[model samples]
Target: MSNDFFSTSNRIKSTPFTSRNNMAGVKKYSVYNNTLIPTVFRSLKSDYFHLIKHVQIWDVCCQKVIEVRGNNALSLMKYLFCRDFSKIVSGKSYYAPIVNFEGGLLNDPVVFCVEKDHFLISLSDSDLFNWVSAINHTKEFYADVNETDILTIAIQGPKSEKLISKIFGEEIKFLKYFNFKKFFFNKESLIISKTGFSKQSGYEILLTNPNNGILLWDLIMEKGKEFNIKVGCPNMIERVENNLLSYGNEMTNKDTPYDCGLGKFCNLETEYEYIGKSSLLKQKQVGFEKDIFKIHFNYEFDDQPIFFNNLPVFKKGIEIGKATSIVWSPKYSKYIGFLIASKKIMNNLNDYYILDKGKFEVSEIL
Candidate 1:
């Protein structure tokens, strides 16, 4: 393994569970929203295997939340993203992809309707606070947008339900996927959501009291011993193999929701006046040059593939697109990743190459 630097200061804040992560002997970390988030606890292959079979806890406090409340909060939400929020059901968490005026993605967050005028936007690794605050500053909408202090933790895997039920009771196990409800744990109330960053069955607990952080962690850890729960974070190998796109990696400000294979989440036919509706409509009418793909390599890489940025992909020695994320999947025993290929070779992915040598086996995800 290679050594990379991760320095924390007053600017790069630490989560409430940072000390516990250290005690767990965390191996690596990735900075999200100017906060330290554990990337690996034990090892990549081991963590991935464990996450698929057993349960694991994650320090996801880095998922900053922005609260938009008031009468016109619905109008402001309509102007934010292309997702149709007019028919949002109660007790449901929505996956909203926020975009700028140019139809380019700004940030994709999970939104919860706290009330009719009150909504909490759980963000994903980007500074979306300033954008929302600035837009609502015009006073066109009578809404208040502020950054909230919400510390979040995730319990993920196949056995997550059993582990969470030990403390929160069996009623929480029935909360529908992408749904949330308030549950009591001792005296403190935890906003438990049946949502997580992994493909496994899991839940994210939001702790309002920072003082309750370690106590809650210890309780879960103690009770979870029977289920073999271990400290873990978002594993790259599992995410890539499952085609779970990470913000700032799989998609960025340079691409739109459509370009990143998130078009179905958008509603262009609806008459909702969103920020980039026109741009998205025009792009859809004209067509995009690239889209994301699920891919694999013909050659077996000896070491784990750790990519910092998108690697240039080529076709017959000509640059076609880039491989945004890559990892050596131990289960697949090959390099599986996501590729954004140009329209010319997007349909014919067999001719794609990464190092000007090997070919790619691309298939449609879902």
Candidate 2:
């Protein structure tokens, strides 16, 4: 890779863990949420194996939060996302899918209940921050909406509990999945949640104090050495195998939840009004013409495979739909990826093929 591939500039901000990531000799970088995120370290394959076996620390500060507080905070939450927030308890989190008025998928973010009337929309790579701010200003709701400086550090893998217990004590293991609690580290209050990007059991610590970023990273590395912990990023192959969808790749503003295989997350029975409630109800009734599918490439390639977004999906020379975010899966021994194609083609998987340099079969629907 050339230096020009991802040159450093003022426009592309660096996270608090940038220096630590450089010390780890990060191999590659990817822009996420306008921040430089470590993509690879030693090697993708080696990192994947280590992550599954041991544990690794990930600097995911790029998972920015859109903080909403004040009297109408809950109102704003109900107005934006499709998930029913009626049952959301304090100190817990829920995966909420934000959508446009037309029911197009805007962004899928995890909503954290910090206080009785306070919520944090920990977002993926999208400009939903601006959208939220605009909505707050226009609505004049009794709520304050602004971006918070809560940096997230992820300790992921099987031995994640072992590593976290050393610092936070064994009681840290008691936190249930998708639940978060405030704890003291160096007498400074911080939030740790049993949530992560990978399917593996882990936790993401939200550091309110920016100064503790390097200290926390160094402590984890120092305490984690006995566990053979390594610095790594989210593995592409592992995420694909788990059917984890990536924003700006698997689906975008042009796509709806139905098209992206996220219909189950949408709450249609709720009587409370949401941004796209009516549109989503209509979409649910009419049904989707296309949906997401997993593709498997037959040929082999040593280098990383490149997928052109919206690559034509063909069936007996007739175009049905398009593919996006195709990645080679070493675990499955094939190039597997996510794509959106006609429901007809997805149902009759024996016929459809992804048109790339060569044809690849639509392996599975997940």
Best by lDDT: 2
lDDT of 2: 0.83
Stretches of candidate 2 above 4 Å error?
Answer: 1-5, 300-311, 352-354, 363-366
Q: List the residue pairs that clash in candidate 1.
A: none
Instruction: Give the range where candidate 2 is weakest over 10 consecutive residues by summed lDDT.
Output: 300-309
Candidate 2 per-residue lDDT over residues 1-366, each given as its tens digit:
314457777878788888788888888899988888898898877788888899999999989988899999988888888898877799999888899999898899989999869998898889798788877778777588889899999999999999999999999889999999999887799889999989878999998887787888899999999999989888876787788898898888888888888888888888799888999888778887678877776554555553334566676777766666566666777666777766765676665464753445555545
RMSD of 1: 2.6
After superposing candidate 1, which stretches have Cα over 4 Å from the reference?
1-5, 300-309, 352-366
lDDT of each: 0.82, 0.83
Per-residue alpha-carbon lDDT of model 1 for 1-366, expressed as tens digits? 112446557888887798888889888887899988888777788899999999999999999989899989988987887899888766788898889989989998999886778888999989999889888876477598989889999999999999998888889878889999988766888788999999898999987787797889999899999999999999888888888899998888888888878888889877768888998888888897678777666454554345325566666777776776777777776667787656657666455355434444433222
TM-scores of all predicted structures? 0.93, 0.94
